[model samples]
Target: MENLPKGSPKLINAWAFYDWANSVYSLVIATAVFPIYYESVTSSNGGMVDFLGITLPNSSLLSYSLSFSFLIVAFLSPILSGIADYSGNKKSFMKFFCYLGSLSVISLFFFRDTNTLWIGILATILASVGFWGSIVFYNSYLPEIAFPEQHDRVSAKGFMFGYTGSVLLLAFNLTMIMKPEWYGIMDETLPARISFLMVGIWWMGFAQYTFHYLPSNVYNRKPRKDFIFKGVKELKEVLIGLKKLTTLKQFLIAFFLYSIGVQTIILLAGIYGKVELGIETSQLIITILLIQIVAIFGAFLFSRISERIGNIKTLKLTIAIWGFICFAAYLLDKDNKYIDIQFYALGGVIGMVLGAIQSLSRSTYSKLLPETEDHTTYFSFFDVTEKIAIVLGTFIFGFVGSITNSMRNSIFILAIFFLLGYIVLSFMKKIEPVK
Candidate 1:
């Protein structure tokens, strides 16, 4: 593998390109089309599913499945990332998961209807694990590819790539779905299933550009026969390392709190729109598309803002807006006049912060790290923190919706998390990454 010098533009952009490759899964499958498809399928089947021998509402079942996937990532990343760090194989680990996720997404084409619900559920879980699992290693590369002063711009650049790439593919997907006749498809469900296959293909096909450019192992370390045990030892050492880094620990606490709300909102917004507000599928997807379009600007704008105000304040600003979004969401009901317009307005607001916060959060964590080569091990903690938060958030969303039969109730409760995050963030001492 060719080694690029540190902080080179080509190297940084190549790292960012992976976001372009993989974010289609996040937008198309996790956020927009697949959830709507799942909802329609379950709605036709009396809105119920039996999974693991327990009957659950279709929406709740999907949320629970996502929560389960996050749980898997949370548990597995620490070990795998430690191994990647020790063996200098982080890129390999990333490719393995990417292939796993893309293949699983392709298999979702087999999920034709309620009868193949297991295919849908199983594929959803595996694909999610693949996307997020690969993300841990991908994120670990940030500090390696960019100077500290440039982390915000580089991170935002990645997200802009993600937003732009995802939107283009989703636009294509939406056209296929809305106008199935253009493709000579009369089956209502077949269009969505085809979209699923395309998402898989898009995810795998586009990733090759990144894989081609990215160096496999900068460290050049070889694994021993006891690499697994060595990896576990590294995991233990990072825990001790975390205990010494007070600011990073504090930031993780705040990040975890806010993520419970932010992640849950991203994952469930489609369901909330469809189930809680009775939004039409086309309108809901269009609103989500609007968010992706807006998020590109949001990421670029906020990255520049972070350079001026610093990452922590930028994050606090984004979180404040998130708090507003949660409250506004709780206020929405199906009975409101011009409800679609209101939803679109909220989608616009979400767009403004969605990419900004996610990009900033990753860079902020990167900037705060004590100088170390075990970036993957350190970032595994970060990814684990996020995955655990998502797990809790999705579980709460599902459990509350199951009990109250209204996801609006979940929205109301999630706002409190942001408030707590805001308070916790204030306690983190302001420090410049490059000072």
Candidate 2:
């Protein structure tokens, strides 16, 4: 492939458009509608879910399933990313997972009742793997499409698009669930089922606009018959290279620590609100929407702040706030008179830092990567790092919640992770631009 010139507004926008395409899965299926739907279903069944012939608490089962999916992504990313780099087919590998994820989402339309519990859990796991697997390739594109200095703004733009697109679809879905009769649907579950269908359609349909413009085979490598093994070799090289990139290695350590808190919080916040705070479905949905709306502003606002304070400092600030959020969440009690108000207030703070930290983390890591053509392999490491963090975090959160019968205890554990991540970030030196 030709060496495409960087800083092309048209090209960069095309790349960012993928976020608008796929984020529906994040907000609707991963973050909102499905989790609530899963809980509501199992709660009606004596608050126990039958998982692979064993009954488990509904939250524990869901957490384990999600943790398993992230573990798959972590295992697959390194090898798959190597093949993509060696074959010069990064876009193809990305497209494969995008369709895998989107189609799996559409298949959720069949998950109608408790007896079909396996379908919901299996489909959710596959869709999650698809969503996260594609992200490895998608993130590898940042350094290729933009100069290092442009990384922050470009990364924030993608997230801004994501937050906006997901919120629009979620708002529409919430309306259908709140008033099903307006659509002539009497089936109590049909509204959410249709939302599942809509999310799949939205994800696949918008992605075409990105696929049409995104470059394929950018490196134009011609792989030999041994390309399969060549891919594994690519991973080994990155592992060796990381030893010299001390700051980047240090940043990943800090990122892993904080992500255990950040991702666990994002994944379980809905359940915590439902069971711990006794928040109604309507209030919980509204709070998530509020977080998404606030996150749009947060993404760009922190991007601007990073221009003055630099990425490391901005990230440290966000991590500090995340630690505060964890402690604040632990304090929320259902017996309180102003429980809903306090939860909403806490949601405001979560919204402020959620997108800021995420966008900055991706861009900051992109800026730190050394100049090389094996970007897919390199970013795979970053992707694997976070996915592994998710696995550990979710597993711990679920284990603690199941044993103690209190998710609040899980939140308290996450607070310590954030604190540890904050302390690690203090040692990171200012990074120089990759020449």
Candidate 3:
């Protein structure tokens, strides 16, 4: 692979702008608006609802839907990524998923009643696949667009942009939700639905800035007519090469271990607060907004810390902090006199590490990669690990909560995943940063 030029602030900023585009999906659809909306629409009578042929609890239904979506992505991303690398069309693939996800978000407007519950379920699945699928190609751009020394800062900048942009949109949505009458709308559901539409538009519109700057292929490969077969051949080569890339493999193992805890917690926090702790919807939104607001600073702060102490140690610090968060969460209860305060405290801690861990992990993986043209294929493996971890995490969390009828124990159990991540990191052979 040829070494591409880097240090272009304009290109870096343009690439980072995609985060500003897509993050509304994470905040508005996945984390905030959609879950609450789903519960309100599906759990209408406060009883089990019939989904397809099966009757299941509303929370379990959502969890299973998300797990199933991640499973699909995990299976498909590597093959698609291989095609993308061979075809020199990572940007186009990213754009395709962006459109699919955004359009699905807009389709969610019609999911207003129990009869249309399938719309919400199906849209959520498609929207999630769109978002996460786009991410595999997006993350591949890091090594090609920025120098190794700049990876931590650039990755954090992207995340910071995401956190700030999503927080702004989520805050606006919260206002519309909490004070629907202010907008001359009588039905609160109308504003929530409108927020979903806004997310779709916001995602596609800002993404054009990135699409304009990101090249079709940084390596400038000219794939032949047999590119489809070539793509599979390349992926097979990468899989075989993995045996010799011990450092990269070890880091991915550590990453997979921690993501099981981190991603699941992010996905489930709002629901757990609402269902288990009896927190109000408005309060949950406010708390999530707070986490995003703090995460911006956390991303920036931890990037600097990684610069000082090195990426490996910085990631270990985050792993330790996350484990503590799980233990602290286990102690929280609905009946406590200061339950809200404790919940907020947990949110604060989550805010502190959320961006730090994510930013550091991405940059760290980029640092660990060998100089190769198959970046999309390699990053596909990275994304696949996380998606599968999410599947496991959500499945375990939901299965435990269902059987025990308690979210607390489910949350506490996640501490073990973090501990395993920390131990794996401890043993990982540190590769020197790319010069």
Candidate 4:
């Protein structure tokens, strides 16, 4: 592999483009636009509360749904990943899931007013599952394309490009919102739906570059005739791998716990701003824009910091920053005059830490794996833990907010997760990369 040029510009560009492609889902559908639209369409005339089976508000229900969806994915992703690995069809599985997610996101266009709340919710669930399932294979491809030495740089580059792509589309979508009259869209809702469609189109269009440039690894063995049974066998092996994780049990436990907090923060940031702080929808979009813009520079900055302090130390620093951010969020008041300032500060802090935490974690985990043949199985475990974290964090936050009627108070509890993670991370000795 070294005899071949490390990675060509085209290969790198193609790799980064996938990040650009899928980030539309993250920026528009997951974080900024869709949640606001969902709340608006689903809420009562009061414009804040929703009517689920119980009398829960839209914000609370959305949080609960997000958490529930993550829990479902946590149980299922390992099984899917095992199937993909046993079939030697990771790319095929990625493409199938991408289409499923994209189609589900586009289906959001049909959900109008409060009439089809269940339809909207179902679409969201399917899209969320597709988005997450595709990422399992997407992330598994990292080691295949780049050698160990280039992993951090390549991962950093992919994240930076993702932020850039999301920001670009966001800038366009924001313009459409700011000047809806110019686009001849009668209602605000139409344009938002159009924006969702745009994400699907953009994802499908740009993804072709990666599909064309990134060659699949050659497997000399013929696929098993009874692929279903083969998948089952592989899944059994995956369970055995999970059992072996007991050797690094402490680190795994800490990662699982802290990730819940991190996932909650990412999933609920937009809702928290709009619902808790009463920030305008436009302002929420702008705040996300700020995060993406700053995140590009932050990625580079944190990369340098990781070089100096080591990835583990850098991650600990981020955890400390996250704790402070959570405390500050909890302190916000209903008046909301300082809401924008708080969001901007949070965005900046997150931008600085986000890249470091993700890249370092991936690099660190890659070093600790038992073998290359088990990469898909091990990474599937990683994906499951990630979903589990999201499930716990989102569930706890949503459950607490619903019971107490205070999003701010719920946010304060998140600090404990970060603090605990930081403490555990400090005791961990970094593993050397396996040759």
- Please identify model 2 stretches exceeding 4 Å from their true place: 1-4, 402-405
Compose the digit string of candidate 4's lDDT tens values, residues 154-211: 7778888888998899789877767899898888788888888888888877887777
TM-score per candidate? 0.95, 0.96, 0.96, 0.90
Q: At residue 210, give the lDDT of candidate 3.
A: 87
Displacement of residue 7 (Cα, Å) in model 2 is 1.5
Task: Give the better candidate number (2 or 4) by lDDT.
Answer: 2
Stretch of 10 with least lDDT, candidate 2 = 1-10
Candidate 3 lDDT: 0.88
How many Å off is the CA of 425 in candidate 3?
A: 0.4
User: 86-157 in candidate 3: lDDT tens per residue?
Assistant: 888888899999998999999999989788889988998999999999999999999889989899999999
lDDT of 2 by residue, 388-426 (tens): 888889889978988999999999999999999988889
Winner of 1 and 3 under TM-score: 3
Model 1, 230: alpha-carbon shift in Å?
A: 0.8
What's the C-alpha lDDT at position 419 in model 1?
93
C-alpha local distance difference test of each model: 0.89, 0.89, 0.88, 0.75
Model 2, position 395, has a per-residue lDDT of 81
> Model 2 misses residue 414 by how many Å?
1.5
- State each candidate's clash count: 0, 0, 0, 0
Task: Please give the lDDT score at residue 39 for candidate 2.
Answer: 71
